[model samples]
Target: MNVTQFIVDTYGAGTPLVSTAKRYRPSSTATKKGYILIFAHGTGFHKEHWEPIIERLYAHGGPVVEAWAIDAQTHGAAATLNRDAIDEPGFTYSSYHFAEACANLCKTHLNGTRHPIVLVGHSAGAASAALVPSFYGQSRTPPFSALILVEPAIWPGSMIGMADSLAYKLACVAIPRRRTTWRSRDAVRKDLGRRAPWGTWDKRILDLYVEHGFEEDKEGVSLRCNPVHETQPFINQINAVYPVAELDKLRKKVPVHLVYGERNDLFTREKQESLLRGRRFASVIRIPGAGHLVVQEAPDAVGDVLLSILGGLENQRYVEREYVL
Candidate 1:
């Protein structure tokens, strides 16, 4: 697959800029009309984190014309680009910023593109994906043909104060005091490999994180995303439940699919079920032996699920065409 990197200035005057990586088969044409995937990563993760799953998708010969992974303003290369703004004393980040960025890409970079687009996201990225259609309002057509959310972080507004939840602890405790700098990438890798979350991640995903999730300086390599920025989205009380409302509005317009890890590490069963209440979805799947970080723990499984969803979509389209005929 050929990979190209670029940056997109988000919509709205003061919004932060974002970075993206576009991947496609070398033999594929720009004009090919197939599924175009736009991915958004969870808090504290970079765009390249999805590469392992994407490679599997291509290897399976799915009908993917191309895939684009986005870096939220505070994460990945976008963090480096927007350092000054992000470092501002009162600066804060939220899923809404990511939604604006994705929406902007659809309006500018993907405008008039013929391919059906699938918006895929994990955790906070899933919240942003759910909110993307809201930016277009009811009058305009949303860019996404479907959404595939993996371990979505969205919850009801009333659940924000659930301090016992792993998500809250991760945001308010673990992340705030976590080590962010190391003498070398090797050291960083070794350290994280022995830790709870990273230790559980697939080795390939961890390797990718070691390679692309940090920035090097004379002192050492530090996480590209600042801990403060990362924690903000998790604690953004008002924004935490914002996507649930968006999801309700979106369910009628596009097929919404949910992918979850069997373990209830970050979000409990009740939280996951809350997303399904009174809403219709195309499909819901859970990968065993994984937790909230399913993308990292089971990239191959994630890839398989994505391919299956795409296959179903393709078949549905064929059936619709036949019915029309």
Candidate 2:
């Protein structure tokens, strides 16, 4: 299958935002599937980071699938769409805004595809999925059939006013200090290989970051998602908080699955239990020996888990297999 890249313009809260997507169409008509899978990336990462997982999904096919991975506004190829937001340090994005863009993208581009969508997201994108169906208001039916969230960056209502606390303050100071330009891709990779989080990432994922996360410039390659846009979201996490009732409504509309890394500190047992308290169709599974970047560290493993879910969806059965790396 060939992967094609494209872009679509959409309005989010009346503001113009652009989203980029990569499509992998099925090779044979014999295995055509019922749903289109859409993948959304996390903060500071481009849609290309999903390539490894996409490749695995195709190789372990249960049905012919048309899959897409989208880049959020201010990330990847969509970064140039809003120069003002790219330049302004105070400009921040919200989950509702991102959700709106995703919805509009579907209406504009995937309208006649005749496929139920299986929404998959990681980190911040996962949070956006939680708010997509009810973006504008309450709706009886959603566009998606199921949702797979990986380590979503959801915060409690209590953290709404804590944006200016020590953590956000430190992120504000640290993100901008990151080096923006590199002499070459290898140079960028070498530099990143020495950093804590980046160094911990799988080599292929780190390569994708160096490949799609930067833009060519006369001086060298510069980060596409600059520090200003990246740090702004970190400090503005309060804007991402939504009523639990809204999420509950969405979960009732479709099957929602949560995938977390065993070593990830974000999803404590109490937090997971709280999230699954009243949601009957919601389930949780952990990937052992992984952290918040589990998808990156073990795309093949994650891809296997996703395929099982998709198979279940295709056969009208629910499979919540525990995946251990």
Candidate 3:
């Protein structure tokens, strides 16, 4: 394995934002008694967006830990990842599959010998974290030490009515609707979310997207996450190859924390309840007056809650498991 650092460009944060990672050494010995935090970036956002959040976790977390954040496939520097094979003959990539692959990657490449990780994903990433582990393999991981799902956009799984589904279906239409490829970044922005209400992001964040979402197309300028890369993924997700029922299938032992912004239009109160379905085992939080971008909206509140969870986890003592080493 090549142990080095490199950057991959993505549709959202390609040139402007950077997703950088570094490992924290636990100790010389002791089986590396530390936790691992694997982050899943949000839609139209990359890992760099979580830099402030991750810094808060590092600063406040107890028992010491290591963390890494991945740019969601096709969204960040990992944009080129599987680019050539978006709609490959043998490849079937769903959101669930994407999450599983990320977990596998974390297990394989992350510099730690630790079990019982602290898995956290934001927006679409949160949905994946809340749902993927249970389906990975029988008894492989105990549904992560704690799953933190933050303000997932397309949430409340069952509240998915026909109208919303239809809207998503229309978005999928972008797959075959290659009428005129955008030649400039301006064209792409004009088309984003139908240009209605623009995006409810911090103005600076929205500007950053404009800066990164477009490139110098040979014809003029074209968007990187074009029809094929995006529309196909949209198609794949709606028709998910493997649907996760709930967290139970993953493992009941692992706890889950579902966090959302109170004022978030994406994961509204009703939408979150629908997704969670009032599950008893998991924890739920509604950040007061926050929006879809909770971390950026209320960094202090988010950090406080996360640190509280980690603090509780740090105090728990695990019993010996039967194993042959």
Candidate 4:
């Protein structure tokens, strides 16, 4: 499947929250009939991780639909944002920057669109996308037409609260950092290709994984998904609380689609319900045998599910709108 890489250049000051992205458009073109989907990829990987799933959708789905995948700040091809590296003793990794990066993309690239826009995310990326409604609300950014979050890491605290924020900060610091080794890294790469406990995915989805996923020097090669910048704080309850409420408010403006992989260890059903239960225009989808990387684990099924959701949003005339103020 042929594709094109587009740079949704966005930067953040706190960490090396650099991001790059890719998009997959349908091969066949009609007068046009679908929504614009902005995809957020899982952590410890790059945007390319969702390439196969996006490609699969492009092949079988409507011309009315389009899909895209973005790297979290400091991961994938977004190496430039590494300027102010994380060097402090207590500082740690956080997905806070990912949310900021997503907001900037919607403001700079996705704003003023005529078609309905759906934000789709997986794992950490899903966590990032899941925050889109709230994040935009805090910043006065335009709201999306709908949202689709897959097994996001949004429920670290059971509820979105201070304890959750602190725990995430501490965990990013506490997790044992794996030292690099040429032999071990090669093994990790190999393992990533095989079927996960819940599902299967192509290893090639992460050739870009080679960059941050591997650390090289005199030591040769070692695993490297959680770079210092990746570990830096990107989400903060106190700092980003407005966005969370914005997400709630945006529910009044557009439909919100939430999806989860049944095998996902990250987001439980209770958490999924918590993320959208109060919202009027929200729907949750559960994929039977998928995991954190649902798109890769069940590319075909993921594609089909996305197509169906897109069709529903289109049928409802869920068009994207721009803010006048």
Cα-lDDT of candidate 2: 0.73
Better of 1 and 3 by TM-score: 1
State the lDDT of candidate 2 residue by residue for 30-121, as single tens digits: 24435677888887888998888887887776443588888888888888666565466555566776666677667666775655677888
Please report how far candidate 1 places residue 16 from its true position, in Å. 4.8
Q: Return whichever of 3 and 4 wins on TM-score.
A: 4
Q: Which stretches of candidate 3 lie over 4 Å from their true place?
A: 1-34, 61-64, 87-92, 140-143, 153-158, 162-223, 227-246, 317-325
Candidate 1, overall lDDT? 0.81
CA lDDT of each candidate?
Answer: 0.81, 0.73, 0.53, 0.59
lDDT of 1 by residue, 102-209 (tens): 887777677766678889999889998888888875776566778999998887876776633756565577787778899999999999999888999999999989
Query: What is the descending TM-score order?
Result: 1, 2, 4, 3
lDDT for 60 in candidate 4 is 68
Candidate 3, position 155, lDDT = 40
lDDT of 3 by residue, 87-206 (tens): 344543346644654555554464244445677777666656655554455646453567777775444334554224434556567445754356666666666536433444444445
Candidate 1: minimum summed lDDT over ten consecutive residues — where? 316-325
Compared with the true structure, model 2 gives a TM-score of 0.86
* Global CA lDDT computed for model 4: 0.59
Off by over 4 Å in 4: 8-11, 15-17, 27-31, 79-94, 133-141, 156-175, 179-188, 191-218, 222-224, 227-244, 276-281, 318-325
